[model samples]
Target: MSQDSTVVCVVCGGPAGEPVYASDRECSITSLCEVVPSPTVVRFCQACGHVQTTEMPGIEAYYDTQYKILIESEEEDQLYAMSNGQKVYRLDHQARTLLRKLTPSAAARILDYGSAKGGTLKRLLAERGDLRVHLFDVSAMYLPFWKAFLDEGRWATYRPPAAWRGTFDIITSFFSLEHVARPREMMAEIASLLKPGGTFYGIVPNTFTNIADFVVIDHVNHFSAASLAFLLRASGFGNIDIDEHAHTSAFVVTATAAVQQGTVAGIPRSEIARLGSEVERIAAYWRNFSSCVREFEDGRTGRPAAIYGSGFYGTFIASCLSRPLDIRCFVDQNPFRQGRRLLDRPIIAPEALPEEIGTVYVGLNPVLARAEIAKVACWSGRRLDHFLP
Candidate 1:
């Protein structure tokens, strides 16, 4: 392209510097990345807050290959194991919560932009009998999950045929925003896909993720809330909002993007103490498990007393434990996960519990912890004392 037809920021049309690898883009019409080195590009719209991206040549083919290679039906086991692993579960919770916030009644028509296997859409539409959903994704495999939903009359799926730009009540993309080259244009596409004054829902990680996670893991850009909102406005979307877990806020967002100002924002902290306090609130609400964890010296053995429950709580607590109170083993119900090593310690199933471990810390959820303790004590035939009381 000539200098007269030169690229600008998609959102605000600012003079884009020629950064080596730019994520922001200028034009929504063209594919977003280009290889640049010397000037260092920063294409952003001043008025609309839109971001422009620089694309690498052949990026399109790469993304296509990634989608097919990843979501292929043949790799079901690998996908299932990784996709449903511990980390994804927590992230999924945020996605579900966002869907709920965006469309409360379930009576509206909804579309999940990158509907992988349609699991999230499936979960969102499960309760509301009035919901009608459509699935859109690059991979053809996602068709069946939505097909099942359609066949069950749970949702009606539609593939945007050539030149088919229909309006909808709501549109959503969970963890899929960073993958697009022209985020501004993609935002425009989303708006065009929605009816006038329609709602848009999205969830993106904070701009803290590494770029390698981008190149190798299907992400092209990492966006901050301010940048994202600016991009949306440039796309002709009037109301734009974005948020995420801040401070100790682990992984995931509690709500989706609502109409512009109505969207959630992460709790902001003005100072160090305030930030610490906010994180403490997050820990109390989401991360913390033990109300009070206390350890005592085992006078005779001197071999530090141990606790039970090998989940996140136990893992964290054990790591924080001091010299004399070092943990020896962990107990859990899931046989596959049990007998595993956590923090270099054995996570044994309760059946392996032995006598003389005497006092045990029940770090699991209270109700479930009690039941597990009962099973462990009964099955092991060991008179294990619990710390709950």
Candidate 2:
């Protein structure tokens, strides 16, 4: 597979870099049965050490309907579910830290870009009642959530009047940039929307540190610390502060819009080499992972099996395996998805997982997956397998 020369590095406008992975199989954010196949190719940009794919086709159309369906498929009250193991539960802690570093201001106009279901904004408003909060997302499916919980005057669906330009004191994009086709353009637009000296705080997957992010089909851009800094600076941002330790496998950055165009720095030679090595390492890991999954599936051929966690990790496993596993059901904790069918397999809640299921693949982030599995009372004596390290 070859890189499209016309599509340059999103951060530096340099040449399309190196190909890291290509798959002819379907690559959809949703499950295999629900989506049509769109072949995927991921590349590594040496210019700024960013990893991205060729711009996806019909991205707007896909996000409008398919993405909205994905949101609706989840529990309606999931945003408020602050359970320890839930995905967005940590957003409360993360938001508190990011907001504290902000310069104290009265009635600050804060916008949460890509605020799906308005969860972060809800948490923010609770912490800072004085903030004039706003919400924007591609889909309006969460409008009811906004109407019920947020200030009526604050929310819009990516349509603000011309007068609203450069009016915001702070803008945040959490786990949204990776899904965008043109990250540079997205950053520039956000810069234009902010007041002079306005801060932009973003959180994206730290691919340099997390291998799992590499295969996430929905995430087009895999940003490292260096890549994110370069993209922010090129988009007229300065006084940048990036924290890789504040969150696991994510880069939390705080940048202010500069009065003039910000300077762009080159990626270090050592850093470039390291990124290349990491790319190879991840590719190797995927090959090994596929082989391991196949072997495990073969060993348990006659027995009924199920996968835990129907989110990204489990969905990726369902989508990528070459040989079909005898997966009878998908075990998930989210109530909305419990009765849905994914990959032609019924999605059941943990309590619904039958005793006939001899083995359960723990398809979740390895760090806390074991503890999460232990919490399920019914799976106490069943065999558990780990697919991720």
Best by TM-score: 2
Candidate 2 C-alpha lDDT tens digits along 130-184: 8888888887777887887776677788565566689999999878898888888
Error of 2 at 243 (Å): 1.4
Taking all chains together, each candidate's TM-score versus the true structure is: 0.49, 0.87
Per-residue CA lDDT of candidate 1, range 1-389, in tens?
22322565444455543322322222111111212222212233332322234554455664444344224341121111122223234334644576545555547777777666666666666656577777776555455556766654333333354333555677777667766776766776777777667777776644232111212223345454555655665466654445554211212322222245433232233332342343234324322222244333223244334567655445434533445245677776555456567656677766676554765767554434566566543455555556541
Clashes per model (N, Cα, C within 3 A): 24, 0
RMSD of each: 12.8, 3.3
Clashes by residue pair, model 2: none
Q: Report RMSD for candidate 1.
A: 12.8
Model 1: CA > 4 A from native: 1-10, 20-56, 68-92, 152-159, 162-166, 209-218, 246-389
How many clashes would you count in candidate 1? Answer: 24
Model 2 alpha-carbon drift over 4 Å, by segment: 3-6, 24-35, 73-91, 150-153, 321-325, 334-340, 366-378, 383-389
